[model samples]
Target: MPTTFRQHRKQDDPVLTVDFTRFPLAPGDRVLDLGCGAGRHAFECYRRGAQVVALDQNGEEIREVAKWFAAMKEAGEAPAGATATAMEGDALNLPFPDESFDVVIISEVMEHIPDDKGVLAEMVRVLKPGGRIAITVPRYGPEKVCWALSDAYHEVEGGHIRIYKADELLGKIRQAGLRPYGTHHAHALHSPYWWLKCAFGVDNDKALPVRAYHKLLVWDIMKKPALTRVAEQLLNPVVGKSFVAYATKPHLPKAQA
Candidate 1:
């Protein structure tokens, strides 16, 4: 997530990283959307009949998320038995009992936090044994390009602090006592948008190139044109903006008498 004007808008559709097909969300599952920036995943989980909790440190985002969840409920968007909650909280110190959640998702958030492993440990602690986790981070290559292009892209407070290579992140997941089952990349078409932003200026969304690229991204996301979709699929492995990994908290072994 680059420090851009894009962060301010309420995304009509979630900018998804974890594919639902791979990390399935069952009905009534207790899901924690840790560091849920704009409650995108939380809203999806709610629509899927899960008991969803969207937690973030930013109270403003939390309030807006809560409103959206409420609106969804009033509009009958969430199915019967699906519940959603938005709360302001810290990722490093989750305010939940041990084994509290059936699923946890932290998307495009760890890179902003300094103690990435500490956040992982907390997520592992709250997740029930055999529960699944979906973790997403900015891919190193594209992120490095943004950094090289402009300092303002990531130098600000609450901006991305580090990029994660696939192996390095997988190793951390293992260290956190989770067994990684699957991994993938997403938002391949969105990478160039940030590169343009960095080259022009992180805040200069008005730049002609930036404006043009932004429209292209908005078109792809909202309209989902077949051409761009196919192009994204082809390019994801090589230059996806986000790296997604799915893992499970291992159940402890039984002891012999």
Candidate 2:
């Protein structure tokens, strides 16, 4: 993985918050981490005893994630029956049959794709009726700040093409034939860090303020200090960096006799 990707994976809380109780994940559940960059959430699902398939278009990332999956299995980090596989595949044309997976997670990815609706349609196609899906994107307000602060933040190749308002995203999910039931924001504490990077320069890692904030974030993720934890919960609702929406594919209605 690239240094920046590793840093974010290590520091950033899992954006979709894969709490099984809320997300309808069960042991042996077939889970697809669509756009599973670096496979953080995919590995988590494996550890929770799910059969996970981590798919991404980046071949190198897929290889690295596969290596990690093997290492996790060898090290016994994952549960006894859990399994994982990684593959390089396009998000818009997922290589799976309809209703193949029970859970799907796409995080911080839609903003990068030009045909987001097509991707959502693919997700819906692969999910079994009543299966759960989680979609996350950079929230409008904070993402707008980053875009305003530095064109470099979004103007690059494969960078975020648009910011998503919460309602707009949920609306798209509903349009895809999924019934949205829950929504929340996350990574509240990491918002300012991006703003600072955007303000200074995305590559200015040597800047004192950015470096300091990075350390603080790393510490918070590693140590989970109560003060920072509570602070993040309080801030998440107001300025959380990512908007997460959860929905389920609706089961077909019973035919009248």
Candidate 3:
């Protein structure tokens, strides 16, 4: 049985919605997990048989993720021939060369960086032609509620600098010369939870409603059943908290004479 968020709220987690396995990650594909805070999606890529480069700006998170990758490697948890390495790097200026990675995952990351355009450029630069990139950010509506409730929510260090609307984000990606392909929302049940937190205080753990909602979300993530599935699916298009946009690097040739 595959582990869900509930069973293990570990640093390395498999997010069901992103569906990393669906990507065409063969044995030798190079995958980059940009802004990989704790190697959650990066570990998933490694487990799914891709060579993963987990990059993060936070030194501590990078250290922890590196440890987990080493541990996973020793334990033989990663797919045969799959490997991962965590590196401390800035998203705006990726340390890798152009066309270095076949796939790039940037989940819940762009919102935190100020120069998101620079980051997107770096993502597009490192990705090989015809490679795919997946980016996730807080959906507009839910993020607006949080912003309206508390300026402090976005003011702190490592906090979200901006909330991205679906079209705006995709447009920026397209401007960087990538072709947007598919988009979806995720974590539908968790929106109200953040709303409650923002209503009370972004850091207020004493709020009963927030605590209760958090537990419920944890429960839902852990024990996936028919009811939650239907509810999440129905709610996703309406009130999902995170928006995921997938795009591919354009590979079309110039018009010939």
For candidate 2, write residues 1-257 as lDDT tens digits: 34444444455343335445567668899999999998878977887899999999999999998987877776666787788999999999999999999999998999999999999999999999989999989999999999999999999999999998888999999999999998888889989999999999999999999999999987888677899989988999998998888899999999999
- Candidate that beats the other on TM-score, 1 or 3, i.e. the better one: 1
Query: How far off is residue 114 in model 3, in Å?
Result: 1.8
Q: Compute the lDDT for candidate 2.
A: 0.88
- Residue-wise lDDT of candidate 3 within 140-190, one digit each (tens)? 999999899988888998899888889999899999999988888887888
TM-score of 3: 0.91
Q: Give the per-residue lDDT of model 1 (tens digit) for 1-257.
A: 22221332235453677799899999999999999978888888888999999999999999988987887877677899999999999999999999999999999999999999999999999999999999999998999999999999999999988888899999999999999999999999889999999999999989999999998887767676789889988999999999999999999998877
Of the candidates shown, which would achieve the greatest lDDT relative to the real structure?
Answer: 1
TM-score of every prediction relative to native: 0.94, 0.93, 0.91
**Decreasing lDDT order of the candidates:** 1, 2, 3
Structure candidate 1, residue pairs in collision: none
Task: Report the number of the highest-TM-score candidate.
Answer: 1
Over 4 Å off in model 1, which ranges?
1-11
Top-down TM-score ranking: 1, 2, 3
Q: What is the C-alpha local distance difference test score of candidate 3? A: 0.83
Give Cα distance to truth, residue 12, candidate 3, Å. Answer: 5.8
